[model samples]
Target: MKIGEVSGHASVPVETIRYYEKIGLLLKPDRDASDYRVYGNAHLNRLLFIKRCRNLDMTQDEIRELIRLSENPEADCHEVDALLARHLIHVRDRLSELANLETALQQLQQACSKTGTVEQCGIMGGLSSELGGLSDKDTDQRNHVPGTHKPGSH
Candidate 1:
């Protein structure tokens, strides 16, 4: 099958497949005479797994670790259990941080009740020095800031 066919069957984008291959997550496919990528059942299965893991919000490092563990079929699954438990803790921490962010936003929003000029706005005041304007600590602890969301690049 061609790249497009594999992508459709796996429900993953072509660019994402290429990226995964580049990052050593997925193996590079064979090329046809025309230099078109030729994918096989293994590629399709790997892509499907990757897509599902991404949907679960798992990180690339986490996926890589999981894949490594999967390769040793006879290995105990205790490592996998520990990995998922750690991931769950991370998710819970993020949820708590997001709740704090939501409260901060709500308080900022409630600072102003009636529509008013910018000079008279409480919202503006909430952002001013007098109001101890928000200087939120960066909640995200990822290596990269994710400034631009390049597809499957993380």
Candidate 2:
């Protein structure tokens, strides 16, 4: 099969496959007489596994470790378990941070609920606060803060 065939069957983009190869995640495929890259079942299988791991939000390093462990069929899975537990903890911490962000946004919304013109808009006032860098005209700080609440549709 060709690289395109592997990409289509594995649901990974051609660019991503090339990047994996460059990053040493995927081995470079053999070339044919026409110099076109030729992939086999092993490449397809590996690409699919990597896609599944990415879908699960596993980092590249974690995926590499998993691949190394997979090569040792007789090895115990304790390291895999530990890695998953650590990922779970990171997820939980992010959730907590999001909750705090939600509360802050709610408070900001409440502060701006009063009817006012554009000149007296509460939401704008909160965004243009003294600490919001509006005085310095630095709007790049707008989305720099993580876990922000997007006040959309309401």
Candidate 3:
């Protein structure tokens, strides 16, 4: 099939396919007599694998490593386990960060429950204090520090 067909079937953009080829992630397809690229089942399968990895939030480098491992079926899977573990840690950390952000936003929302001028708004005051270079530790304990939260708990 052509690039467009492959992209549609794989649910990935054509540019992304081109980039994968450019970065040696995907092998370049053969060209037909008319100069159109000729892709095959191998390309389709590889593209789908790449798409699935991306959907799982795996980085490009990680995908590359996985592809390498796949090419060497005799290689031990310990490294693959390690890579997945690392990615899980990152995902857990991000989930914790997002939860903390939600809590902070909730607190900020409550700051000015009653409509008032800018001088009387607590949310604005907190934001301004942050922008003014006040240390996160120096701020009220109720205020959430963006990156200080632990994983798996709000």
Q: Which candidate is the best by lDDT?
A: 3
Give the runs in model 1 whose Cα sits over 4 Å from its true position: 128-154
lDDT of each: 0.78, 0.76, 0.82
- The number of the candidate with the highest TM-score is 1
Model 3: residue 16 alpha-carbon error in angstroms: 1.8
| Candidate 2 residue pairs in backbone clash | none
lDDT at residue 26 of model 2 (Cα atoms): 90
The alpha-carbon deviation from the true structure for residue 69 of candidate 3, after best TM-score superposition, in angstroms, is 0.7
lDDT of 2 at 67: 88
How would you encode candidate 2's per-residue C-alpha lDDT over 71-100 as one tens digit per residue? 998989998898777667655755787687
For model 1, give the 10-residue run with minimal summed lDDT: 145-154
TM values, all candidates: 0.81, 0.75, 0.78
lDDT of 2 at 25: 85
Error (Å) of candidate 2 at residue 73 is 1.6
